[model samples]
Structure formats: structure tokens, C-alpha cells
Target: MSNDNAAPSSSSAAANGSADSAAPRRNSKRPKYSKFTQQELPACKPILTPGWVISAFLLVSVIFVPIGVASLFASRDVVEVVDRYETACIPAQNRTNKVAYIQSSANKICVRTLTVPKRMKAPIYIYYELDNFYQNHRRYVKSRNDMQLRSNSSQDDTSNCKPEDLINGTAIVPCGLIAWSLFNDTYSFSRGNESLNVNKKDISWKSDRDHKFGDNVFPKNFQSGGLKGGGSLNESKPRAGGSHCVDENCSSTNFQKVVWEDRGGSQQR
Candidate 1:
């Protein structure tokens, strides 16, 4: 009886092993269906209707109306004096050929008398404005190397400012149309022959002078190209404070100019 049972058990084991081996295996690399892949999961989606759109507009108005009114009220105390001197500053004889006038080394200064209705309080600001110049154009926008500005080590990394990027393979610091065409205008504030002390110290953005631009970085081959733009930079000094005041496009009071650098695009004002 024991012999018969052992033989039957061995035969059953062999049959089971043979059956398992003979079954076809599933491919491990095969993709399987998933609810996520098929996008069958439930979600909350907002539909925009006429009522919903109107509600959104009302909500924005409710939140921003007070802020706008408050801003106007606050700025009312501040006084701004703007002088568009591009045309007035230029010598009448050279108005037609402003490009040549700017390129020349001749003195570019004009005194324009300004009448301020309200007295400019302390911390009087000065500004210059531009018209008909597209500083945001694609070519002008991409013609800068921020890496070079941020770090002294990356001065050679001027791949963006092509054409103005280099001079005989030497990279330009602050290379770009923005930097080349820097706002080189100089202003002297005076009220009836009394020179007001224009406090220029710490006027620029603290974050930019300290962080955005590297302290070790200075100008190199700037305005050295065939066609020079607005300004020239000091070679020995670092760019921290040596650079021209260009944090903004256009500010201060009723003032007269002693000297103004004629710098801008062909169509600039």
C-alpha cells in the first residue's frame, strides 16, 4: 500500500510541474490599462457662464477699487516734474542730423527754464523720457548677457549679445543694446541760480547694485564698437556704482541742465 501511494504522489508532482512549465508567460514589458492614464478620474472643473464672468469682474472691482483710490490719494502729496528735452536739448542746427550731432565730440548742453507750480520738497527726483523707441523689440531684448553682469567669472559668457557681444573675441561686459545705449544724460537742479544739492547717493535700487550686478564686474570694450551708443564706463572701477544711473527709463523738479549727453535711438525723443 505504501509503495502504491508514493508512486501516485510522484506522478502527480511531475504532472503539476509539467503543466506549470507548459503555460504561456505574460510579457512583463506590456503596458496595462489605468484609470489615470485614461483620464477617467473624477475632478471638479469650473465652467464659465455669462453670470460667472460678470461675478468675476465684480469681485475684481470690489477688491481693487479701494486700492486704486487710496493710491491716487497717497500720490497726490508727491509732485513730479517732467521735462522732455530731446528736441529742446539739441542744437537747432543739428536737429535734422541728430545722429551726427550725438556722434560728434561737441558740447551737447542746453539750459531750459522750468516753472514749477508746486515747490519740490526734499528728495526731489529727476527723470528722462523716451518716445517712438521700442526697447522691448525681440532683437534688443535678447542682446544682453545677464550671466556676465551677475558674476565676474562669467564675463566670457556673452553668447546672447552677438554682433555687439565681442571685439576680436574679447567679450564685452554688460554687453547688449540696453547697456550700450545707457541713459547717459546728466542733470543739475537749480532754482533761479541756486544749485540744489541733488542727493544721488543710494538713489538706485539697493537690491540691483548689490545682487543683480557683481561687484567685481566692470566695463570691458564698452562703447568700443564701430557705432557707439549712449555712454562710456570706467575701466578701472567696478560696475557697482560706476555704471550710469539707468535703473529707470524716465523723474524731478523745475530744473536747468548744464550738460546733456545726446543719446538715444534714431526715433527716440
Candidate 2:
């Protein structure tokens, strides 16, 4: 009876071992779906046919050709003339004089003759370009007080004007980079035999519409005389030899002369 029971137990153990080995083989033989492994992911395969390539080139040419022609014609119409008078003024000689004359005659004025190659069209615009003059610098630009410009008796805002704004309770009228660094260069133009006139007052913006400085608020210590404190810009003056003041105090004033020419009419500077 013992031997019979032992034989049955051994046969049952062998059957369990065979079932475990078959399970692994069945899992390995399972078929993998091609849709889940490869076909589900996207891929780009560009087909660059000659027709598509030719169409793109034609579209670009159609849009840009007319634009290029129009730009060329417009550029041809404009005629610009520029003259930089680098060394126009000649220094005066003082070799003999012991005292050395402080203000020399030569340093006062500089005159140059510019001949135009071709006559410019009607309404010719003239501008002076200062290459080294940096008006956009941080220290030079933010040197003015807006409150002081609008008010005559207003105290100096030290944060804006710094060491110069408030000297002894008197407010520096137009204290800033714009007022300090004033352009003093003057220009005159003569075309052929006719002397062109430049209207300086018209070049600046209208105070009523643009500046809007209150009537009560007048520039303090303002010099009315020719370029003394800062020239008086309110009055209209001729573009001739006279020094027309454009600043409230004509000390350091930008002397920009704006000239306008009419078609077929006498030239108005």
C-alpha cells in the first residue's frame, strides 16, 4: 500500500513540472499586432514634384518683381546733396604780437561756397547733420526738468537737474541736456544769382499747439539780445547775417535754419 501511494505522488510532481515549461512556450509564441508596433506612429515622406517646385518660384517672382520696379522708380525721383564743411575756418596768425590777441578775427566766422551739380526739384529740404553730437546719451539726455520748463517760479527738482539746476533759489529755465548742448552753427545758401531765404521761426514747432507753456510761466533770467542768454524764438527773424535767438535764454541756442523753395517761384529760404 505504501509503494502504491509513493508512485502516485511522483507521477503528480512530474505532471506539474511539464505544465510550467509549456506555459512559457505558449507566451513566447503569441503573435504581436503590426498596428500597435509600427503603423500607429506618424512619418513624413515629402514628394517634391517639378510642378510644385516651379509654382513656388513663379509665385515669389510675381510678388517681388513689381515691388522692385516701383522702388527703383521712386528712388530715382529723389535728388539729395550733402556738404560737410570740416575745415572751413582758417586760424589767424599771431606770431609777432606778444600779448596774443585772445579773440582772433578768423575764429569768428566761416564761409564756404557750395556749387550744385544739378538744380534740385521744387520744395528742396536742407538739413545739417552733426555726427559727434550725442543727444541720446543718458547723462546728456536726462538733464532737464519738465516742471521747471512749465513753471517760472517752480523750485528745481534736484533729481533731474542735479548740481546746476538750483544755484541760489533761482531756477534754470530750460535746464536739461537739450538746453545745455545747444547748436550754435549757422548756415547760408545762395543758388546761382538768387539768394535763397531761410525762415528760422517756421522750422520750430508752434508753442501754442506743441509746447503749451503757460502764459504766466516765463523763462527766468531770459536773455532777449542776440544769442546772449538763449535767443528769443517767439519773434520771426530773417535768415540773413543777424544772430536770431531761439532759446529763452539765448546763451546756447540751436541755430537751425529751415529753407523752403517753391516751384517756378523765387526761392524762399
Candidate 3:
């Protein structure tokens, strides 16, 4: 009877213990938020509304607006400067009207008078482009041919002077007269004391009291025996110094000296 009672008591104790063990553990992941310490929980904030979103958009605009505007103006300034030097002072000529139109595109570039700002770091580039313009200016065959003839005569040391008089008063003409002449011979251009040499010589020579053109003219005695073997040409060396002066008869003439003065001017004193 005692053993039966002991077995029943033991079964009751085991049943109570099983019920306690089945209860949910406090540290399990299912409801872990409840176990979080006060310091471990994230702080809560109010939900964003339409007003907050609008305010944020205005804040971004205030920061970037001035930056964009400044950049636009800077770009425009760069474009203006480049355009100034790109166009021609004279517009391109066309078939209808063969004359070129004068247009002021850039300040004329000159070496001595380099008046324009040399902001360009690459001088070789500037020189190349300038040369191209000059070549195009000379390509008009008919116009250039006529202009060349005129240019040569315009600065002719013999111009406006009678053959009888070696020294004449100072004559002033265009600067292109000297520039073109030297360019033909040397393929370069320059302006300096040499540019005004013609006037300087003439002015100094005029101070002589006695001046005659015939004294400066070439003598007719030295004509190169009118070509050989029936050729109507005169192969003689023209004028003494080989200047490009020819008589109305097409006879070659030479210069005694570059100075324009009568042959006997120094002896007159």
C-alpha cells in the first residue's frame, strides 16, 4: 500500500515540473523588444509632413542658384574675346562685287606696334594665322598684279622727278609703298629708319644749290649692241647700279649711286 502511494506522489511532482518548463523563455527572439534596456532602444522622431519637404527643397535652391549664374556669365566673357580676333577686318570678296568689304574684326597685329594685348601664350599660332590672311590678300591675281605695279612706282626714287634733275623736294606717299617693295625682294616686312630713307635722302640732297636731272640720268652711249643675230633685244646691263629705271625708249638705265643728287653738286662749292 505504501509503494502505490509513493508512485502516485512522484507522478504528480513530474507533471508540475513539465508545465513550468513549457512556459516561454524571456530571452527568446520572438518578443526580444520587450527585453531591450532603456539605453538600447532607438529615439523616436515625428513623421515628415508636406511643409518639411517644401522647406528642404527651398534650402537646396538657396545654395546652388548663385553658383550656376556665375558660371554662365564667365562662359559668355570667354566667347566674346575669342570671336573678336577670329573675323577679318575686311570681309571676303564675292563674284558679284569683286571688291572686299572693310570690316573691323580685330585690332591690326603688327610686330613693332604690337599695340594689342599679347594675351595669347602661343605666338607661333598667331603668326601663322596672320600670314594666311596676307597670302589670301595677295591671291587676287588681277588686283594684286595691278597693285604691285602701282606699289613699285609709288615709291620709285625716280617718281615725279625730271630726268634733268637728280635731287627733288621730299615726297610723301603711303607706307605700303616701302613695305611692299622690300617684301618683294626679301619676303619680310619692316618699318624703321629705312622706311623713311627715300625722303631723308631727297631732303638732304635738295640743300645743294646746284641740282640737275640730266646729271643723274644714264648716258645713251653704253647701249648693249641691240641683241645678236637679228634678235630685236638689247642685252646690255641697264643703268650703272642696276636700279629698275627705264627710259621712254625702253633703254636700260643704271644708278650712279643710291644718293639722289646732281653729279656735280659736290663740285659746285
TM per model?
Answer: 0.61, 0.55, 0.18
Best by TM-score: 1
Of 2 and 3, the candidate ranking higher by TM-score: 2
Clashes of each: 4, 14, 10
Over 6-70, each residue of candidate 2 has an lDDT whose tens digit, in order, gives 99999999999999878855357656868667677667977989999999899999999999999
- Which pairs of residues clash in candidate 3, taking residues 3 or more apart in a chain or in different chains? 89-103, 163-213, 164-212, 164-213, 164-214, 165-212, 165-213, 239-253, 239-254, 240-254
Runs in model 2 with CA error above 4 Å? 1-50, 90-107, 151-159, 167-169, 202-217, 222-269
Tens digit of per-residue lDDT, candidate 3, span 82-192: 222223433344323322221222433423323434343331211111223232233221121212122334333433222211223432211122111111001123345
Choose 1 or 2, whichever is better by lDDT: 1
Instruction: Give residue 251's lDDT in candidate 1 (0 to 100).
Output: 20
Report the alpha-carbon TM-score of model 3 versus the true structure: 0.18
Candidate 2 deviation (Cα RMSD): 12.7
